[model samples]
Target: MVSTTSKWTWKSPGDETRNQIDCMMISKRYRNALLLAKTYPSADCYSDHVPVVGKFKLKLKKNSKPFTNIKFDLAILKTNQTIRGKNQISVQNKFEALGDAEEVEQQWKNFKSAIMEAATEVIPKVKRKAKQKWMTEEILNLMEERSCSKGNKEKYEQIHKKVQEKCNMSKENCINEKCKEIEQQRKHAPQTMYSGFA
Candidate 1:
């Protein structure tokens, strides 16, 4: 089959001449899928031959296997002091009771399974929301303003400065709020009090 269009895709540096050395090839079965093919000599690739790019319409197949969700119960270690202590104790006991295996790989796997089992028993799985809870509405507004100011260098810089200031303010506010909460909960053990930071 011949190319749908004629174009020179390459150039010789020594002779200062151009030639169609590069091509965008496709199967006979997907000939209709070739939407556009063109050469760009001024693409700044720093080579003797220019670039030939093609745009094709094709269907992609999805994966057969389901997506695996790996969840870590970090909040249990921070907020649930009782569960944390229990998990730690359980881990220690299981680790100590583990006998030596002939293979280091087997021993490592055993240790991992033991710790996972102990923590799984103590900590409940929680599906966390995919967003930063600390980010304030004011910060969002400033970000929106910055996005709207795109292409205008002066406006972009002004909005970007405002965004930075708002972000700093939001961070300080979150820290101050957490500190106040920790202070209020200071009646409890120091560990639980500082858990607010987590």
Candidate 2:
């Protein structure tokens, strides 16, 4: 298909000549789904050929599962001493009440049920806070400002730098927080940390 930008995709180093050698191909069945195809001349790729980008519109089917497992927010148990003590006591009491079973399988089932019941009664489920954990309102605002200043090169560059700086800072902070959490887990629950690798 023809590129909308009408820019050459390749250049000769010696002669500085440009050519549209690159092309995008699509299957006949999905050809109509292509919205736009273009070459970006200003892209920072250190190659002879410029990058070709294509936009397409497609309908994706959602596969919903019949059942989903619930995840408990166990971090609360580590942070709150009272809840941790309560959960331990509840599990211990339940185990004591379970008594002896006829078979090993029956004993295991009883123990599992007791733990599940205690967890369900005491622990809270995990809650989704945001789609992107590292993204903040300030970074989003800078991105919006960059998009708005696209027509003005100077303004766009200024905002783009700011956006890059903010994104790097936010990502670094998120990584640092994650590292701290890992260190805490390593110190307090070394077995759990090693179990994750398994």
Candidate 3:
């Protein structure tokens, strides 16, 4: 059994990794019998760790048999008729308190806002390369046609510049100095782009 109250439990996994709770592995070097409840004391606090629980008396054999060390590896099964009846009533009240459609809609909006912050604000953007990369013509066309906000357009363009750098490409070939007749370039010196960066 594992303690639920232990805060040093779940290790924050990397982005794009599957969401999985940390599992509690039983110790294998035991010389004697081991009880489930005896191993894990804070069973009520852990929301994920304790996979099993129960209330049963031990009936250990005198002989050291295999798998006999585990004294009941299961949760206590309760089937009280009165408790079930009360639970139905409680569940109905809980559902009723959930309010109506408008509240649910607002909740959905809040969820969307959270998703945006997590994906956009928190996670560092990683640029990927395409074998058939979008040419300047395609990008220019996209800029002219896309209906995103100006801020979003600028952010996306910056990300694109980083992506270009990752593929060992540069715009130095395109940027001609002091050629006003052709397209006038920006004043700032172009900076180098880095890996996994945006």
Candidate 4:
């Protein structure tokens, strides 16, 4: 017999008795891994039924995939004209030098390796940060204010409007900045730039 704190999992309004509507069961083999199972009424699930949570103690296997990953600086490929041109030429020369092969798959592998080597040499890799630059201080502050005023609907609505306005402004700024960057790249690297209509 399994011993538990509360016997019933659910209850009805009109009915005088409550019944066990939920249960946590484990197989005989994993019975020892079962840690605890209980119900909490103050979990704020917005329902008549309380929340039931269970904890387990089991060992998990680690993933076999390597943690480190090779990163390439693709941004330079478009922005730098010299590196881009030289890298393309190098890749073409390497592919031509490879000549014909017996298997088509082997030929493709050789071509791919040549291109990868050229990219690694011409384009340096840089680590990127996880944080977003577009998330301005005003937006973060407004979000904090909105969260703090959760119970007050009027205040929350006012803050929400301000947050929306700030978000729109931030989006516009980001677009303008990107446009400026593209303009700069086009002006500096005219040879690489293409007229889309042409």
Candidate 5:
């Protein structure tokens, strides 16, 4: 292939000519999410054409469900007698204060509001925690290294192998940990285990 400073996407082996023939096509909807799209010539794919990598920073919209966010930790009510009693008293007082509504719908709304208000006042909210992922920081770093060393075939290949190995090991470890957790739950809290499946 013809040696040049500029990056080329493809190289004709027989003719020793290089050209940027490959292109990336993305939807207009996700145009803003496209951070970078480029070709890496040193990537050892054992082919005339190089790989085109596209980096995206996607802002996914969360699924909106009715009354999903205001989840009160009901488990606390089961464990703490004081909180349960307070909640009961609060609901009773609210219901009494609500009086009689003219319509059935209004009465139902009032009842629902009363129960929600009482729960909000007495029960602690369930804190939304980020879901745990199988991918580890070490694996991520290795991937980053591989991306960075894409200009050097030897370095890229080395890091790529390491990334694959780390990914497999991490996935296996995550699976084993989950299995152990399930076993423990099955032994100690069989009801909870069954409920999880349901």
Candidate 6:
């Protein structure tokens, strides 16, 4: 009863004592972003190292859009949609999926909107998002790549400008806001992250 706690002793094979031997094998996969955090093993430093693992996806700069084309053999399809003398579409098949003229017109309008959006409107926004996301990820990845993903500097400032331009953000806020982002990614993501733990 005097020394019950230290009384018991255990022993294992020679390989068991090695530092490289991961008990839970957590580091091997170390994919969880939580485990790599500053307070991973429980937020309370006074308490035990609880090992709370948080996982995230860097998304490879394919980032978020935050956010296809098909063509038939032209000849046959045009014949299928040929119109008549009185501006009436002569459908030899007559198996028109369109219910009514108004409906057809509305459908065409909607299609036009979609096409216009794809060709003109949506492309810009999508390009902006794409550019922004890529720049954001690139900045993050660069800082990540260089281990200097934090701070307000000329290079990063230029990056923020580009990203903001794509996102249509105001110049006033881009510097401060974007810097904050850089800091976050730098602090959380490790140098070895891109390469991996294997």
| Ordering by TM-score | 5, 2, 4, 1, 3, 6
Q: Which ten residues in a row have the lowest lDDT in candidate 1?
A: 1-10
lDDT of 5 by residue, 29-138 (tens): 98888887767777889898988887889999886866445778999988999999999999989988999999999999899989999998988987544244777777
What's the CA RMSD of model 5 in angstroms? Answer: 15.5
Model 2 lDDT per residue over 1-198, tens place: 556566688989984798889989898988889998888888999888889999999887687955546688899998999989989988888977999898999999888878888898888877444467898888877776787688999999999999899889998998788777778889999767544422
* TM-score of each model, in listed order: 0.33, 0.34, 0.18, 0.33, 0.35, 0.16
The 0-to-1 C-alpha lDDT of every candidate, in the order given, reads 0.76, 0.83, 0.40, 0.77, 0.80, 0.38
lDDT of 1 by residue, 1-198 (tens): 224464767767685876777777788988888887877766898787767777889877899978645576867698888988999998878877887788989889878977887867777766444256567766776776787678999999999998888778877887898888898888666668877376
Q: Model 6, residue 55: displacement in angstroms?
A: 5.4
Poorly placed runs, candidate 3 (over 4 Å): 1-102, 133-198
Number of clashes recorded per candidate: 0, 0, 3, 0, 0, 3
Which predicted model would earn the best TM-score? 5
Structure candidate 1, residue pairs in collision: none
Model 3 Cα displacement at 126 (Å)?
Answer: 3.4
Top model by lDDT, which number?
2
In what order do the candidates fall by lDDT, top score first?
A: 2, 5, 4, 1, 3, 6
Q: What does the lDDT read for residue 61 in candidate 3?
A: 54
Question: Which should have the higher lDDT, number 1 or number 3?
Answer: 1
In model 4, the runs with Cα more than 4 Å from the true position are 1-16, 21-71, 93-99, 126-198
Q: Clashes in candidate 1: how many?
A: 0
The TM-score measured for candidate 2 stands at: 0.34
Question: Candidate 5 — which residues are off by over 4 angstroms?
Answer: 1-68, 133-198
What is the C-alpha lDDT profile of model 3 across 1-198, one tens digit per residue?
Answer: 433444233323442332225443544654233443322424566343323332334455585645422222112114455544544455445444544446777656555544433333323343223333323544444433442434687776765665455333324433322243133222342242221122
lDDT of 2: 0.83
